[model samples]
Target chain A: MSERGLLIVLSGPSGVGKGTVRKAIFDSEENDFQYSISMTTRKMREGEVEGVDYYFRTKEEFEAMIEAGEMLEYAQYVGNYYGTPLSYVNQTLDKGKDVFLEIEVQGAEQVKEQVPDGVFIFLTPPDLAELKSRIVGRGTDDHEVIEERMRVAREEIEMMALYDYAVVNDEVPLAVKRIKEIIASEHFRVDRVIGNYIKMLKEM
Target chain B: MSERGLLIVLSGPSGVGKGTVRKAIFDSEENDFQYSISMTTRKMREGEVEGVDYYFRTKEEFEAMIEAGEMLEYAQYVGNYYGTPLSYVNQTLDKGKDVFLEIEVQGAEQVKEQVPDGVFIFLTPPDLAELKSRIVGRGTDDHEVIEERMRVAREEIEMMALYDYAVVNDEVPLAVKRIKEIIASEHFRVDRVIGNYIKMLKEM
Candidate 1:
């Protein structure tokens, strides 16, 4: 019997390198996972492609989708809307491909509520000092902005207790490897795999 | 803060290659895990080393340990005693090392009941046919013995629902690699790691 795909929700503090880790996972040949392209009302920046990087939408369209119950989980951040499309995620899983959603903590909890079987993985820096250093190393934000982000990070770390597993982003390759393993192991979960086997046997 | 070691329980039906997978994990340089040696009243087999393989004790001594509340979990099988010592396991975890325990389904359940925090991993053959092939592949068991083992295997598969995760032991190295990943990912669990940071902040 063929197995279904896993819905994996990945979350972390802002400076925890979730984006970098996600890119590494995508680069790895061992994993055949699909990343859910989110719908957002935010104006697309340079190099961001519509439908590839994100499903960019007008505020009206985003609100309509939300009203139609099309979004699995959505949130508004600084006057911009971002949410996952339930149909797209379900389609991917139905095709026996895992769907990875890189989301924030609140969005992760919402996805977990909607898809109780989805796997939640939280990424973290080695520690606070390292997280601060990484934030400063990027040179993208001023000290005030970094301080605000770190405060938010502290709050997010507290919510890490809600995640099913944690991956420390001490080393890039190692974190990506660990994430790939988690996906592989979850695929072999007895309830998901053996249940299908038993059903197939009964049909025979 | 130093991370604590994970308590990993590995179990599977007889001849599903749980032993082989465990050995492969031990051989890996990435895994610095210690295999928990069980205390047993069963007579030592050929090439078995005391303390290294198992702690061979007299029936009276085994019972005394049980009575003293030193045993983590214990069970009787084929008129022989087998049990885990809590002190040894605790000491290993205290030293920030993960401990792997290979036991039967019954013993795995007992260990889970005692230590609810322990991670349970079940290994299975790819299919019933593969299970039989592997059982017969051993070149020791006769047809009747093989058939009986298959029957027991079905019973074991039925209990797969109780396990948190399962790995099909179709390929030994792949299965071991998945197990190693499970251990590594488990270390990232937010409940175990983030609470201390939050607690330390509150105290400050």
Candidate 2:
């Protein structure tokens, strides 16, 4: 039997640049893991590909998937549904292909509940002040909205205790390098690689 | 207080090239961890440095250290005592410098009991056949001795389950790369890095 692939979940506060880091990781030449396309009811932003960035779906279609238990993890954000599709993740992993998921903290929590063995990474800004600046610089949220995001970001940083690794997203390249190292090192973890050795011992 | 450094223990069966991999790691430009010097009762061989290779000592001095609990982990092999000095390890780690210990599996087991938090790595040959060949290539043992060594090596591989990571020493450079990645990734583990975040929360 083939070894099972890792389920890598990258998550953090709303404005921690999870999407940007995920893009950098995918764009890197060393990337061997497959990206798990999330299905969302949110409008496609400029230059966002239909299936690459997200599997854009209508609210009705998304709700049907949720009803049919097709969604791996889902959450409502800013009046839109966002989630990973279940079958693709399962199938890819079963085929020994690592699946990468960049999702919100709430969705990550749900994924943790369902698949506790996944490598859950919390991408945090260098500090609270930096996190606030990133949120404000987005230019999308108003003053009150930005303040609320900072408050929520603070809470999310506290939730980092639940993650396996907390990577400071101080620089995109450095964060990418650290994430790659985490994935490479995790593959050698004894629990994940012991089965083959056990079988070898039995054969001996 | 500074963050305590990691105690990285690298071990495997005899002739698995543990020393070679450890040397390559130290020689690398990225190596920031401190090598923990071991005190041993063995006679210094040709070209081996007194304080660099090991702190060679009389059998009496080695026994005295063991009696005083100054040795982190010690074992008698080939009628000689080899062990890590507890004080140096503690002092270096307290100063936030990582301490690396490359020792036999027997000594590694002792360290596990005392420093369960240490990152225990098991370096293995690509396969049992490769392991046998490596031992045979050493040319120090006869056929019967080689067979006995293989038996012991098999048992050691069974002990891989106790280690945190199992790295295949298929190539020296590859093994070195994997070990470096393990150390880098370990630093980011939530349990190790969470204190700062928790402090930040308290301050906020």
lDDT of 2 by residue, A1-204 (tens): 247999999999888899999999999978889999888899999999998879999999999999998898999988999899999999999889899999888899999999999999999877653553466667887889866866876686678877999898989999999999999999999898777555544543
TM-score between model 1 and native: 0.83
Which pairs of residues have clashing backbones in candidate 1?
Answer: A166-B188
- The CA lDDT of each predicted structure is 0.81, 0.86
DockQ (model 2, Cα): 0.47
Residue pairs with backbone overlap in model 2? none
| Tens-digit lDDT string for candidate 2 (B30-89) | 899999888888889999999898999999988998899899998888998888999999
Model 2: how far is B83 from its true place, Å? 0.7
lDDT of 1 at A125: 69
Q: DockQ: which candidate is best?
A: 2
Query: What is the docking quality class of candidate 1?
Result: acceptable
Q: Specify the poorest-scoring 10-residue window by lDDT in model 2 chain A.
A: A195-204
Tens-digit lDDT string for candidate 1 (B37-62): 99999999999999998999999998
lDDT of 1 at B191: 72
